[model samples]
Target: MQEETIKKFMYMNRKAPYGTIYALEALEVVLIGAAFDQDVSLAFLDDGVFQLVEGQDTDGIGVKNFSPAFRALGDYDVTKLFVEKESLEERGLSPDDLMELVWEDEDDDWAEKPSIRIVTRDELKSILGDQDVILSF
Candidate 1:
């Protein structure tokens, strides 16, 4: 039997959490890809950084707040969440504005580690270049 090759998949999100379905759709796809044992990572740039901001209240918008779902990504082994630093700066935001996301590293005796990485645009470009497949939303 041929060995299954695990492909590197990167989902690039460039939309707001609400006002459109792009952010949510990309998240769902990321989970599906991870379930297949593929290498998966997420890139949040532009308005997509808003997706991870803490204290999200959608009550006034009549939409269910899906921010909590991001916390569950680590459980699914979808831990690499790369947020572009420039994007946050442009919006007058910082890493402190994002929700705290961590994953348990079993190899490290289950020590908790952060999943979100605040990367520069140049760093993100290199990461995107290394991916086998990149789906932008």
Candidate 2:
């Protein structure tokens, strides 16, 4: 059954892109959320930040690169991609180092941001105000 009542949503991806299915699963969830016509937000945290690392090499794993799917986020209207600034700093990464469309501001104008924004964890948790649902991927 489909739920027409969905309003706002935020997804927290908290694992490494490889060595696990979290990254791929999260991407699928984002796609489905968009298909449902609900507002969606994706936040990358912890080891999950690896999903955005630029110049990924998955050939050794014998799997296609999943980074390209991330770039399609905007195409599906799942444009609110977020990254915990601290997470990146801790991992020594910058938004420029990742793949896909992400926000640089709360209103990064999903249609115009050249690159994704880097937000602090506190800022992320705070902005999540009144979301109908929060899913951790």
Candidate 3:
């Protein structure tokens, strides 16, 4: 059997969750990409961090709040979620302000682990360099 080439795929999210469809569309792509069983990672920087902010009330705007979808990514094996620290700080948000998302590591005794990773801007640069392909939204 031929071995599947596992590529490093990174989704660069730089837009806000609402006012447009970029964030949601990116998420749909992420879910589909995860099915390929590739090394997938999601980077939330700039206004993209807003997508992780808790208590998003879209009720007034008549939009369905899809923040809960992030919590479901773990089931699809999409676990590497990186958030820029400076972006969060600038937006007055801490990790506590985001939803608690976790993924089960089947290779590591099926242990539950936090999927979100808080990284500095420098670390984010390195992360971008490490990706084989980057899909920006």
Q: Please tell me which predicted candidate would have the highest lDDT against the true structure.
A: 3
Query: What are the lDDT scores of the predictions, listed in order?
Result: 0.92, 0.77, 0.93
Score candidate 3 by lDDT.
0.93
lDDT of 2 by residue, 1-137 (tens): 66767678878788987788878988888887788888777778888788888898889999778888887776676767678899998988887788756433445443456436578889887867657788876
Q: Say which prediction, candidate 1 or candidate 2, comes out ahead on TM-score.
A: 1
Which lDDT value does model 1 have at 26? 82
Per residue, candidate 3 scores C-alpha lDDT tens digits across 18-110 of 799999999999988888878999999999999998888999999888889999999999999999999999999999998889999999999
The residue pairs in collision within model 2 are 15-48, 52-98, 102-116, 103-117, 104-117
lDDT of 2 at 44: 80
Clashes of each: 0, 5, 0
lDDT tens digits by residue: candidate 1, 58-112: 9999998888989999999888999999999999999999999999999999999
Error of 1 at 79 (Å): 1.0
Q: Rank the candidates by TM-score, best first.
A: 1, 3, 2
Mind sharing the TM-score for model 3? 0.95
Number of the top TM-score candidate: 1
Tell me the TM-score of model 1: 0.95
